[model samples]
Target: MDLPRTFTIRESEHRIHNPFDERKLADLGAALHLKPGMRMLDLASGSGEMLCSWARDHRLTGTGVDVSTAFTAKARARAAELDVAEQVSFVHGDASGYVSSEPVDVAACIGATWIGGGVAGTIELLRRSLRPGGLMLIGEPFWRKTPPDRETVTACHMGSRDDLFALPGLVAHFGRIGYDQVEMVLADQDSWDRYAAAQWLNTRRWLDQNPEDELAAQMRAELTAAPLQHILYQREYLGWGVFVLMAR
Candidate 1:
């Protein structure tokens, strides 16, 4: 019903769960040109940031579903704080195989395609809830550059180079899957720093306060190594972006 404790604790203060900053999130929402009152269905919607913020800024109405109970609660509170509670709602449930009860203007699964196995399968799942000609949003990572070896790939947390495409290949992939890539917003190294580096502080603070906790050792080890690991592997080889698509 929730993310693993260590993960939740590590990202305890994250309002947006991915490697996207608030500015990028706003730009992505604006790029959609979503009309007022448009309905969106968001799967794996961590903390409902996209839904709630869009509800407030774009006058969007949406539902967000995620398996993380802690994040779901934060999402609800966020909706209320933004005065978008009536427009956006969040549900604490597994997003895998989820479909909206009604057709929506947008169907999204941001940074959590594993909910449906991968990009193609996740798209199929989202298609079930999208209105004809409606938009779909997928946030995913791509290869900035090919890794040098299996070790580098593993350092990037990917099983192999086949796990993702380079930027051009990723766009071509959408075409191959029968979708038109209408728009996209990419994340730079700065965004990656914000996303990954922020975890260190959170982990450090938690360790300082809960030194006796069982997970402290694990977090300490991770915090110790994650920064340089990210700089050496991910910052140079990995990239992320939110892509907008429509049925072709």
Candidate 2:
């Protein structure tokens, strides 16, 4: 029903939750040329930033679903803060197997494709809620450079080399699944730094405030090791992007 406390603690400060920064997010919204009154369904919608922001900027209405109760509350607050509470709603529940009651103009599963087991299954899940001719958005990671060995792949947090494809290969993947890649916005190293490095600070600050907490030791260890791990492994080998697709 909810995410692990450790995971929520590590990402408590994140608005978008993935590697994307505010500017990249806004740019993606703009690139879509979103029209007012369009409807969107966002699955695994961490903190609901995409839905809330687009509701404000594009005057769209949307629903976001995530399993993290803390993040779901934060998302509602953000909707209110942006004065778009009426345009967007968030549900605290599992996004897996979630299908919209009505078809939407956009169906998205950003950065949490595991909800549907993998890329192909995730696309099938999203398509269930998408109107014919509607767009689908998927945020995923691709290999920036082929890892030299198993150790490097593990360091990048991937179980095996097959877990992700290279950028060009990823585009080809969408095609194989019967969708055309229409647009994409990628994350630079700086964006990766913003997402990964920022967690270190949050963990450190929390550890400082609650040294006696049971999770403090774990947080301390993560804070000590995360930055180097990210800089040396993930930032170099991994690239992330939000891709827009249309049914072919």
Candidate 3:
């Protein structure tokens, strides 16, 4: 019914729930060439930025679902802010087993493939709700190069090197999952900096307010140490991109 307490806290603060800034998300959505009537189902749609913006810009209709109540509220508020509340809905629930009541033109699981255990399983889950020829939008991270050491990978919160694939390998992974490469929008180091660095300030602010909270204390320590770690490891050696795939 909810994500971890730490994430809920972060979402409530409007600090780190959205990974992409508005412009990057707009670019990604534009690449999909949405039409007025197209339907979308965005799993793990944090803050519903993608859905709300697309609905406003392209006149698309959709439902966005996430486990975070804080994000769901933000998403709904965003829809209203954008004057697109009639075109989209936000549901606070687990996205892993969610299926659209009607077939959709696109189905997406962005930055949360773990919902279905991994890329392959998540693709299968999304496909069930997609109409024939519907696009699948998968937001994923790929290594810019193979991690030189376990310590480097660990800093990115990865358990092991095998948990990630290099950029080319990730594309091939889609092929292995029976999807064809269509289009992609990659995130550069600057974008990653924006995403990762912003969290530091958010966590710092939270720590200022709730110094005694255990989760905040751990996150504070982690956030404090993350920038140097990212600059040294992830920023120097890894990359991330959101890929669009079609069933082959």
State each model's C-alpha RMSD to the native. 0.9, 0.8, 1.6
Shift in Å, residue 38, candidate 1 = 0.3
Candidate 1, residue 205: how far the Cα is off, in Å: 0.8
Cand. 1 TM to true fold = 0.98
The regions of model 3 sitting more than 4 angstroms off are: 10-19
State residue 102's C-alpha deviation in candidate 3, in Å.
0.8
Instruction: Give per-residue CA lDDT, model 1, range 1-248, as digits (tens).
Output: 67899889878989988999999999999999989989999999988888998998999898999999999999999999999999988989999968899999999999999998999999999999999999999999999998989989999999999999999998998999999999999999999999998888889999999999999889999999999999999999999999999998
Write model 3 residue lDDT over 157-206, tens digit each, in one string.
79988898998889998998789989998888787888777767777778
Model with the higher lDDT, candidate 1 or 3: 1
Q: What is the Å distance of residue 186 in model 1 from its true position?
A: 0.4
Identify the runs in model 1 with alpha carbons over 4 angstroms from their true place.
Answer: none
- Name the lDDT value of residue 100 in candidate 1: 91
Total clashing pairs for each candidate: 0, 0, 0
Give model 3's TM-score versus the native structure: 0.95
All candidates' TM-scores?
A: 0.98, 0.98, 0.95
lDDT of 3: 0.84
Q: Deviation in angstroms for 161 in model 2?
A: 1.1
TM-score, candidate number 2: 0.98
